[model samples]
Target: MKLSISRYNPELDSRPYMQDYEIALVPGDHMLLDVMLRLKQQDSTLSFRKSCREGVCGSDAMSINGRNGLACITPVRTLHGTVVLRPLPSFPIIRDLVVDMTNFFQQYHSIKPWLENPEPPPEKERLQSPAERERLNGAYECILCGCCSSQCPSYWWNPDKFVGPAGLLQAYRFIVDSRDKATDERLENLRGPYRLFRCRTIMNCAEVCPKGLEPSHAIEKTRMRMLHVEASGELDTHTPPAGRPSITN
Candidate 1:
């Protein structure tokens, strides 16, 4: 199989370039990371980032054949036509296939993902019924893959203003949890322009998600929940300042 890869070295290079690699790939032996390793063996100058060969670590995501994908998870046998590898779009490229994740994590942390209880804890861990746990199911499965956030148009503009997919899912995880009692405060924090308006609902995040997770849906639920909170006449939040439109059905 043949794969075209992007190569760059910031300390020694002015611009990036493409290098084609023709590797021997058996039906089951072809993995994206394997192909990259082969290319590096032939030319040490070739560079890419990879961490767990499995998909969980989310370290090897790149544009595979023009689609955002995890190199570790992409099987060589699944590819059609010439494979084109590029850096994830709309990010500052660090080198070859790696991009700066500082902004991504920054947005993630702004949402205050960890459990925050104004109320004191019980004598032991809080317990809930199975039905209650299911409410936050969609958000709890996220592995912070960055595919959703990177593909998000909101993150492309002011990543700081918008809590991207990872953050939104984390927010959803707690928002729906029956044991958590701070939904209103969290909604209040997210009601402001930077929190709600940033998501453009382009669905790019949902499209590229490796786990088939719908981070957009989580964002939509947050929007609706916030609206309901406002409509109850509690926060006295004003009408959504212009330019913010509800994109969910």
Candidate 2:
């Protein structure tokens, strides 16, 4: 089997280039990450990211044959010929097949991924009914992989202003939580010119998600929540409650 991987070294190469390598494949060898590890064994300079060696951790996400996916779960046999590898699109490359994720994490953090409860703490864990918990089924499965966000055109164009699909999906995760007390504030935060409105419903984010989660759906739900808030005349006087931290980027 042959693998053509994108390579870049800030210390040497001024631009990225593709390098090809030949590998012997066996019946047991399937995942693309395995092939990458084997290639690394031959050349220690080759660099990429992988953890858990499974899809659970999205560290191995890259553009495989021009499509974004986790290398750990992609079967090599499924690829027709030489597999082409590149870093996630619309992100600054740190090195070979590894892109800087600072902006991605910052957008995620801006949405406040954690639950926000203002009520007094209960003695035990905050309990949610089975039906209430089911609302988070798809949204909670996201692994923070850059696939969806990188595929989003709005994010590509406005990486700084737009929150993108992954962040919106997580925003929905906290907004719909039955125990969360900051639903209004969460909706208020996203009600901006470039934040939630930038989504054009292209569905690219949903198509490229490795987790099969529909971030587009989550984004739509968020838009609907925004509409509801607007219809209720809440935005005119909406303010983030005290103690809620502000996110700059």
TM-score of each: 0.91, 0.93
Local accuracy of candidate 2 as per-residue lDDT tens digits, 42-74: 999999999988799899999999999999999
lDDT agreement of model 2 with the native: 0.89
Q: How many pairs of residues in model 1 come into backbone collision?
A: 0
List the candidate 1 regions with Cα displacement exceeding 4 Å.
247-249
What is the C-alpha local distance difference test score of each model? 0.79, 0.89
- Give the Å shift of residue 229 in candidate 1: 0.5
Error of 1 at 180 (Å): 2.5
Which residue pairs collide, candidate 2? none
The deviation in Å at residue 116 for candidate 2 is 0.8
In angstroms, how far off is 103's CA in candidate 2?
0.3
Instruction: Identify the candidate with maximal lDDT.
Output: 2
